[model samples]
Target: MTVRKATDVFSEWALRDRDEGMEEGHAKSVNDMLKMVIPKFTSPFSVIDVGCGNGWVCRYLESIENCYKAVGVDGSKEMILKAKIKGDGEFHLAQLPFWKPSIKFDLIHSMEFLYYLHDPFEMLKIFYEEWLKPGGILIAGIDHYSENTISLGWPKALNVNMSTFSENEWRKAMLDAGFIDVKIQRVGIKEGFVGTLAMLGQKLN
Candidate 1:
């Protein structure tokens, strides 16, 4: 079976209002990632969520005490429309590795996203080199990795192309992007569900 591009699949999901379910379904794992990483943010921080779907993460980031700016970007127009409809944060349309924001952010976050890219490592490099300020943090989380046996079939089930990667491969990707002090761990596991693989890296200048 041929795999569809991720943006096409997700744009269809937005049209069918499946984006709402996405925010609900991934809330737990995304929240766990937020909790683990939020405390590290300094005051007056700015954030950008790549592949932010409906902008749920952007909304939440805006609510934090010291979060000054929160923005969400996705390749799908429908996904961006849904995020704008919610009216909490800035949302934009962009295809990754080919797009860069005019302003760099203090934190960059992505969930259920990186794996969809044909070249996630190159995207990570863009984040490090263009999208983040010195000392900025990049946290990427995904459920569809090699260890999550359940997610192994997602490519066919969802009909979208997904990169199959191991935990170590992901860690190496971050390190190779020139991010320092890289760390990788699993979060939000539940009975049969293996959990999301969360990775973090910082730009140390």
Candidate 2:
């Protein structure tokens, strides 16, 4: 087994939800994400889920009436392999900010993953140009920076690196990347420790 960071270990635990009866936890989180994202989708549309750990969100979206195809992509090979076995949709393993897809999607989603990027804005711009169709929707779910409780002690203990931004900073970055109609809202609060921030935007014509 590879020496994995705490984040990677957590991601691996997500893959085991099917066996642990933790599907309910996954379902609840997906439901919250969908509730924040799905209103922007009007009709039958294709979706790409970036950093889709074990394809839980992809599978959840597939149950929706208007979601035609749900594709899952992840950087973790183990996660992708598990996703392929558990999900009906296609799963690919690729490093972020470098994936090239011939097909564009009506919606591109990233959850709990952007803060790990060294250059989130650069990646967002690439996603806008390469993955999203004109007038497409982008939904990103992040834990609020103001609420981040991972102190240095915690990071040392967990052996993971995390980066975060305030809601305004995220919105500005999206606008600078040429996204329009951007909106940010707090969707879920868990135990007063972690707060979910859902940012939705539309690609301009």
Candidate 3:
């Protein structure tokens, strides 16, 4: 019997959540990253969102006054289809650790997507080396990190591979990935839930 991959299951789950929109309670954490990130753009910038489920964030980034282009790529074809219909970004269906963009981006963002990789730190290195231009910024928003007890069962429950790294471990990974000034900040705290953590990194020449 052939077994289905965990990513396939996650794709199906995300497709079901497509119509819910980013206004859902769980998405508010990434909204805080958006607040902090959008203002830092001094010039017209291009963005690529990795694992951009439903493309809501891509749509919002495109609406920004200084945004030149916003592109979203996800592994789920259904999610990309829904994003095309309900959101306003160049959405593409691509599997990661292999898909390479035609052009590098000034900003690369991923919300709650990195942990799904078996070795998220290696993916971070790949993103820094291939996806981001020099001086570009990459922010990974994570809710299922080691510190977030609320998400301890996510891997088992979803039957997916999740790398539960500590806050400092994530930082060290970013720094080791040739990113400078790596900083991990917690955002969007709500009662009874661990706040989202933003791993911010910059590629400086």
Candidate 4:
């Protein structure tokens, strides 16, 4: 059996129009993450959505009156192309844990993305130090984690590498990555589904 790269699989999803379905599937969890986050930005804010599959979140962020900038970055070429075609905000083609943005943002978001990396905390460190401004917030959501139980087979199913750490481990990893005041919240649970485990952290001022 051959293990496949997550981005390559997602690029195919982009070509097949599966990205829209992914947006729909993750919408509830995404909304829950935003509900807690949006209130923090009393003034104008800028955001970057890592692993932005098709820029849906980027467009939504741009629609908010207080959002000065909304940028979407993804490793998949097809996904970025599709995002650009959708036409709402700036979209960049870049791989995580390696590609750093030219500027930082007030808020950084990643959903169901970090686990794909060999060292997810390496990307978290970058998110804390390079991707976010001082006093910035980082929100990372992952569905595949230990204790979730249902998600344990995701790596094998998708043929992609995923770091299956427990919830506490994720929080500790965030703290280890230099994110202060780290917290985790579970949201959007339904029948037979364990809600998304959203890790919230703040870059120290």
Candidate 5:
């Protein structure tokens, strides 16, 4: 599916179901992303959440002890509106693959968002160069990874364009995008769910 159509479908879903539209499995992935990074914030930090549905993650980050600022960017206007209504943070409506942040953040976090892009690697490069400050961390959680057999049919099942790759491929993409110390992890498994593949990398000076 083209970016336009995908955005429309997601926006419609958000308008209809609000936060509950996000699947429980995907919600766990977001929580895993948060748990993995929250302890890393030793000092006050700024964050930009990519594909931040309902801005719940941003709100959670803002509630952290050293979170100086939390901002959410999403392609769905209705999602942003819902976020603005109940979330405590700055929210912006912008397409993930084209969205650019004016201010670089200490951390760039994305959950279940990278695969929707036509070129996930290109998006990683953008986050590395344009959205993250030097030494900043970029963490992404993906449930539709290639290694997860249960999600192999996600593209056809969800009727969306998704790019699936091995965990190693994801780590390499981040490294190629100028991130150092790239790493990957599998987190939170339960019945009928394969869990989330989390990829992390940090911009180097």
Candidate 6:
């Protein structure tokens, strides 16, 4: 789908309920997840948040003393606008496949956004080759694929699909993308319904 269509779909979802509390709740969840992943970095770092819906994650990173620079990129203009309104770092409205960073980051992050990509591995490779500095870290958090989630009520006609992978699968993919020391761990558990897995890896010199 085109970026405009994707932006419209996300904007519609964001505007629903018109509840500031919901947004705050989502931000809290994201922050909690990041806390688990960010400490793996040993020192001050430049970070990029891809598909940074509303930019909460980027803003949170900017608030940290060890974060050198925080940048956010999203396909949705409306989401980017919201991120800018939050006010801490730079927000770019650009679709994937056309995104080019002038500088490599010490950390690159994406949460719950990889499943939307048609070529996730290719994107990971690009991040490894072009966007990450030597010894940089890549963290991707995703919902695990299991029988319970396949049955969940999801829209069928949007021409969009989510592909979840097992922990080993993610580790292998990251390895193939030229990362080493790949580690995968589950972060949140929702009884028998859902869970999240965070896959982390480092670029080798």
Error of 2 at 8 (Å): 5.0
TM-score for model 4?
A: 0.97
- TM agreement with the true structure for every prediction: 0.96, 0.83, 0.92, 0.97, 0.92, 0.84
In terms of TM-score, the best-performing candidate is 4
- The lDDT of each candidate is 0.90, 0.74, 0.83, 0.91, 0.83, 0.73
Tens-place lDDT per residue, model 1, 1-205, is: 7778789889999999999898888888898888877899667899999999989899988889999999999999999988998885789898886788999999999999998989998999999999999999998899999989989999888888889999999998999999999889898788888889999899987
Tens-place lDDT digits, model 3, residues 93-152: 988876889999999989878887778888999999999999999988988988898799
Global Cα lDDT for candidate 3: 0.83
Clashing pairs in 6: none
Kindly list the per-residue Cα lDDT of model 4 for residues 1-205, writing each as its tens digit: 7888889999999999999999999999999999978999999999999999999999999999999999999999999999999985799998777788899999998888989899998888888888899999999899999989989988888888888999999989999999888889898887888899999989998
Which parts of model 3 are misplaced by more than 4 Å? 1-6, 18-23
- Error (Å) of candidate 6 at residue 95 is 0.6
lDDT at residue 28 of model 6 (Cα atoms): 40
Model 2 is weakest, by summed lDDT over 10 consecutive residues, at 18-27
List model 6 lDDT by residue over 1-205, tens digit each.
Answer: 5333545667666566322443454454455567766787678889999888888778778988889899999887777877888786798988885787889999998876776676777888999999999988888776534433642334244434555456677778889999988877666555553556677888987
Q: Write candidate 5's Cα lDDT for 37-155 as tens digits.
A: 77877889999988888887888788888999999999888888888998667999997676687899999988888898889999998888888988899889888887799888877
Worst 10 residues of 6 by lDDT: 146-155
Pull out the clashing pairs in model 2: none
Name the candidate, 4 or 6, with the larger lDDT value.
Answer: 4
Clashes of each: 0, 0, 0, 0, 0, 0
Better of 3 and 6 by TM-score: 3
